[model samples]
Each structure stands twice: as C-alpha cells, then as structure tokens.
Target: MAVGAAQYVRAMHTVAVLALDHVIPFDLSVPIETFGRTRLPDGRDAYRVVVCAPSPGEEVATGAFTLRAPYGLDALRTADTVVVPGTATPLAPLPAPVLEALREVAARGTRIASICTGAFPLAATGLLDGLRATTHWAAAALLAETYPAVEVDPDVLHVDNGQLLTSAGAAAGLDLCLHLVRRDYGSAVAADAARLSVMPLEREGGQAQFIVAPWPATPRGAELEPLLAWLEAHLDEEVTVERMARQAGTSTRTLIRHFKEQTGTTPLRWLHRARVRRGQHLLETTGYSVERIAGQVGFGSAGAFRERFKRTTGVSPQGYRRAFGGAGAA
Candidate 1:
C-alpha cells in the first residue's frame, strides 16, 4: 500500500496497533478509536484496526487495568500500517523477538508509527537511526541520550519521515492519527473523523505551544496574552512590530523580548505563521481562490503569499489545496 494513495486503495487499509506490556491506555486507544470510527462517504469503514501484542491471550498490564489482546506479533505481517503505543518502561531493553518482528515488517515496506515514548522501542529496531523523530517532551532528553543516532526533535507535535512516524505525548497522538487520515482520504473525510473524535481537524501550533517556561519577574510577559489574542483576530491586517508594541503598551525592544520569552518566536514571524495557519483553514474549508486567500491572510500579493506559504508548509498553495482542500475549493 502506497502512502497517500487514492481513496479506493485505502478503503480497507489494515492498521495493526502493537500493544506492548505497560502500554499507556490512552496511547493504545487513540488509533483504535480514530480509525475504527472513521467512515467513508459511502458509509464504509476507512480502516480495519486490530490490537496485537507480543504474546496473544497473555495479560498485558496497562497500569489502569490488564487486558488480553486477541492477536500476536504475526498480525503485523498482514498489516499495511503498524502503530506502537507508548510503554511505561520506555528505556528498558526490548525483547529480541519483538525487535526482530518490527524490523521484518519494516523490511516489507510497511508504514510504522509511534505514539509518545513508543519511539523508544521503535528506535530499538534501528529504523529511526537517521530519521527525525519526536516523543513526549519530558522524555525527549532521555531518548536523545539513549539513541544518539536518532534525531530527536522535542518541539513538534509529530514528525513524519515518510515510512516512519513519531508523535509527542498524549493528545498529540490524535494529531498524528488525523494527519494520517488526511493523507489517506483527503480533508473532508478527515474532518469528519476529527468531528467524531471531538478534536480540531488541525491544531494551530506544535507541541512547543504546550511547553511551560519560567516567566520573567516583570508583568510584561503576562501582558502579551491579550496581544496574542489580538494578533489572531487581526491576522488580515498589515501588522508591524511597532503596531504590536503599541497594542501591548511596550517599546519594540521590550515587545520583542517578551515575545521571544513567551512564544519562542519574534512577533513578525508569529504573525506570518498565524497568517499561514489561517490560509490553510480557508483553503480547507472555503471556495476562495489563492489570490483571495492571500489578501485575506494579509499578504501584499499572491506571489509573495505563495512563496511564504510554500516556505512554511513545504507545498504551494495549490498543492496543499489539492491534497487537503474540500470539494468546494477552487
């Protein structure tokens, strides 16, 4: 099965979720619930999700409770995609049999993904050695320390390296699964799945948005909260550092400092990202032309909008729309 293939080929895509011992219950349930509930336009199921374990019928402890999986490692052989949920003992050595099974599945061109610290076991198979991967921010340092060959990015909600994918902690798993759904079935179907899951089709930012940082002693950092909301509401306006400073009641230098401390980005860069995010939503949900969307997002011209949109999203406006836009997109 090809990645992002046409909808027909994905009608019955098999997704095998590997539930190891001590698997986080939430992580294990994400794919099952997301894929299991997804329906095609004709009312057919999008994916067939199955829970498999290293040993079938054996009780696996999940902290909250112990349950028996109906399938074993052999289930992976027939799956088009395999998902590994996070485990409590992420740093513990993986059993050689499990590692060998994962490697064999990868060699057969099966797509694999990990949720949270599940990246630890996936890394143990050496498939992620040269790829960019992510995990729960709390365990990022340990993951990097343990697997120096794997490039660990602690900021993004998820990293998709074509065949191998990894997501940040907890709810970020939902983002990754929704992304996969979008890839397989386009935006409209994915949007329906997102609605069923009670999650936004796409989150505005990455896991970095969830990271907590120490605030400065001054009240300036707290003041930016309202300014951030103001920026979102005025994304279509021509925003400038001086304008943001005025809105925040601070000097440009002070505003810049506070933006970096609070949001980890410059004010202008944040505005650009905000515009792109808005542009993405418009493209997905509206019948607006690129030129129209460019202006709506505050770009001076369609040409500049195309450049910045591609720079931030790795695809031209048309390309993104083609992949994720709704039927109404023009």
Candidate 2:
C-alpha cells in the first residue's frame, strides 16, 4: 500500500504555463484555473501548475494589470506539459529566447498546447509547420498568412495534433483544457473538472455553431425567407428536394441551384445541421431520452442519431445531455 501510494503521488503531472508580455488576461487564467483545479479520482490534485515568465523575477504586462510570475522559462525544462495562452498582440514577433526555450522543450517530447492567438507564437517556432492548427477565427487568416506551411482551420473549437494542440478563441480554451484532461485521465475526471468550472463536460457543435449563417445580401433572401422559416418549423418531417421545389414553385434543378447560391450549402446539408441544432436544444433544456430526441429531431433510429450527434458535436447524445441537460438530469 505504501509503495502504491508513492507511485500514485509520483503520477501527478506538472503543467507549465508560459506567460508572455501582453498576454490576454482571460487566456492566462484559463489554464491556471483549469489545470490548477483538477483532482484525480482518488481525490488528489492531478496537476501541479506553474505560471512562468521569460524571466523569473520580472513582471509581465497584461493590458489590465501587471503579473509577477513565480517561475521562469527554466520551469518548462522539467514540466510534463507546456501551455501558451493568447497574447494581446498576436502578430507581434516572439522574443528569441522564449522561442528557443519552447523549441528545446518540444524537441524533448513535452506535450504543448496553445490557446487562441497563442498559436501564433507556437507557429513562429516552426513546430506547427506541416500540422493543422486553429486560432481565434479573427486571427486564423493572419496565422495562415504568416505561416503558410501551417494549416489553419477556423471552424472548430479545438484541434488536437497529438503533442501539439490549438484552440479557437475565448472560452474554447476551456474546451481544449477539458479535452486534455479527458485524454490524460478519462471522462469521469474531466466531467468533475467541468462541474467546477460550471461548464458542460463537453459542448455541442463546432466553432461553426458560433458563426452567423451568411445570408445572401440581396433581394433573393427575401424570396427564400418564408421557405427557410417553413424548413425550420418542419424540422422533424421528411424534407425532400421535390417537396422543397413544390413549395418554391420551381423545378427541382432550379431549387437546388437557388439553395446553393443563397446558402452556399445543399438543402439536405442545411436540414441536417438544423436537425442536429434542434437536438442540441432539446438535450440542453429537456429531460428527453436519446431515443425520443432522435425521433423528434428527424433521425429514423437512435443508433443513427448517436452516430450523427457524435460526428457533429464530437460527443454522444448521452454525453451531451450529461453536460448540458438543464433539469432533473441524472
């Protein structure tokens, strides 16, 4: 028992957060709060979190306040994981010493993660080259433009490239942290961490869910307004191209062309998205069983619903309910 307890104590991971000048306050706080607060199933703290700066005694400037990090870059040398939070000036060049330190640790096979615009610094180190990454949607273009070799995906909440992970803007950092917890431990422990943060264990949908749908900026949108409303209203019904064409007073081919031009997506794809979105709402607000929710969302079977829900939301329907179900949820 004593030996087992010693092994358990030794299993705690160390997470070093690199605090750069002009770092976003919220980004800096996310890892500190998330990793710092995690507890293992045995009720022991799972991670030892250290916030470090380029220099040990120096104060880093945040837009709102100055923070004195207790550790320095050397802390990264012994850490099992390293995290870089977003900087206010993401486009600004990283300090050479900081960059070198990151490269050294990464070469040693330490797991590293970047939150939001932190991808910029990680990309600048040339580590993200030949890897798919994501930053805040607002900065995705810039990250791609600056590091042409890096594939920047802007429509996902987070991207996990094994040792190197990147997350999209703001609260997505929380998502990435929880994902790491799940990867390191398992779902039950991660779910506990989520509760402490008052967040769902996992959120439904991608960054695409947060993006506003682009409607055609023309009189054509007015013509489709009623059709769109009808589609939304009848989400649980079979919506065939032929039925849509009849309602639009046009041939099927013309309706297909009109939908593509107006929504930049096929009619069926749009409907599927709508159904998944409705499923999400039901999961969040109602205590419906997955079978009932599946049928209500137009899926023919619970098995099909589970697969689609996992594909679209990166989580199963039951998992989604556990995270977001509002009242009387087990």
Candidate 3:
C-alpha cells in the first residue's frame, strides 16, 4: 500500500534570512522589511520572508535581545533568495552544517547576499573569490586581508556579482535591498519601495562621499579647511586657482601643493567634483531646468555643465534626474 503524499505549490517568491549568533538587528530586518513591504503592481505581496536559524527553535543572541527563529536550515533549501546578516563576532568560524547548506543552495542557483561584515561568512563559502565585494568601510581592510582571493572594494555601498551580492554596513543594506527590487522588477517598482521606506530611489554619491568628506587630522589639512569652506559657500561664483590662493592667503604654487598633499587632488579637480555633487543633489531634489542648474552650480554654460556632469557621473543630467528625481518632479 502507498501512503498519500501532499505537496503545496507556492506562487510568491521566497526570501530566507539566515540569522547567525549575534546578528545585527538592523541588517536582519532590512530584507524582511524591504521585501515584505513590496507589492506587485496589481497589489499582491511580492515576496514571502522566512527567518531561519542554524537549528529549529534555536535562540540566536542579538546584543539587545534573544530571538528564537521558528524555521530551521530547511527553509534555505527551497528559498529563491537567501540573505545573511553580519554576526557580532565576524571572525568566528561558521558551523559545518550552515556552510554545507549555503554551498548546496548556491550550487543549485539560489541567489545569495550579505550585509556589512556578513561578507566574512560569505567569503568563507568560497563564493566571492575572484569577484569584487565590499563591506563596512572600517572592516574592508580586514575582510580583504582575511580573504585575499576576493577583490575587496570599500568605496561603494554595495557590489552585485549577478548570483552573489554584498553590501556595506547598516543603512547600506537598505540600498542593496532596494537594488534587488529594481533588478527583479524594474526601477519604477523599486522607486515605489524606496518611497515607502522614505529613502531616495537612487542615491547620487558612492562611498567616495564617506572617504573624502572627513577632514584630515593634520596641520596641513587644518590650514586649508577655512578655504574649503569658503569655496563651498561660493560655488556659484567663478573659483579660479588664483582666487582660492588669495582666499587662503597663500601663493598659487603653495596652495596647489597643499591641496594635493591634503586632498590627493588638485584644487580645480576637487572643485569640479564638488560642483557635480551639488548638481546631482539639485537634479534629485529640485525641478529646476538643466540650464538653470548649470548656472547655479557655477558652470559657464549648459553645454559645459552637461559635459562635466556626464564625465563625472557616467550619465547625462536629464537621465540622472529622471532616474532619481523627486517624486513630484517632472
């Protein structure tokens, strides 16, 4: 006699979150909130999120609280996508069973992602070798040192390698999750999700913003800080090297040398980047015409502004505006 078997077919996409010991609450919740809140154009839920632990009914330790995951490793086997958040102890070895499950799922074509130092565990799976990846800026060097085979880039918010993806710390996870929505659906759908989260559809700057913004803690950089502030305040005016030197009370030659020593670039190059960053903000937040924005940002003409903007961002002004402009903007 044959026993009757029951099977249920699932239509909604499944996202499994693997919560290891000492998981970051924010990182773990990002996928659940982002994917869980998404709706199809017709208003149906887009994804079903399942939080799982290494073993069934296991209590995972978060700094603030202990969470007993309802599902076990079995949930990952059938998930369409799997997300791994960073553990409190990133250097600790992953359990053999967990490693085996991740390898098995990845080999079966399941998409996998990690947030922050989660790259550590993902790298251990041998999935990110020879592929570009990123983690929190503070941990980037360590991640690279720990996994030399993985090309580590600490300058971007996230890196997508088709099947494998990694994101930097904290809020960058939100950026990565929204990106997945864009990849699976389209920019419009992702934009809707972004709006729901009160986030920009697409942020303008990359990790360079974080890298370059902090003033160097040196006398050389400190001396130039006032001049940099003045430049920012007067971006709409013509800012020649000679003018900057005058503002800093130095000769042109000395000023150029100091800028290179402090900022790793010439004053003019830095000024151009600042202008472009400002232009990006305008395009994303304002309804001003490109020509007007060009003037506002100190470009001599719309043609000049267009050229500089494209050279800096790899996209035209109008294109960037359309892709990331305010919801009410045209």
Number of the top-ranking candidate, with TM-score as the measure? 2
Clashes of each: 0, 0, 0
What C-alpha lDDT values do all the predictions have? 0.86, 0.85, 0.85
Predicted candidate 1 versus true structure: per-residue lDDT over 79-140, tens digit per residue: 99999999999987888889999999999999999999999999999999999999997788
Error of 2 at 259 (Å): 19
Work out how many backbone clashes candidate 3 has. 0
Instruction: Judging by TM-score, tell me the better candidate of 1 and 2.
Output: 2
Q: How far off is residue 1 in model 1, in Å?
A: 21
Measured by TM-score, how close is model 1 to the native structure?
0.64
Which whole-number lDDT from 0 to 100 does residue 196 have in model 2? 96
TM-scores for all candidates? Answer: 0.64, 0.66, 0.65
Show where candidate 1 strays beyond 4 Å.
1-11, 213-330
Q: Which pairs clash in the backbone of model 1?
A: none
- Tens digits of per-residue lDDT for model 2, 1-55: 2347678657779999999999999999999999889998767898999999998
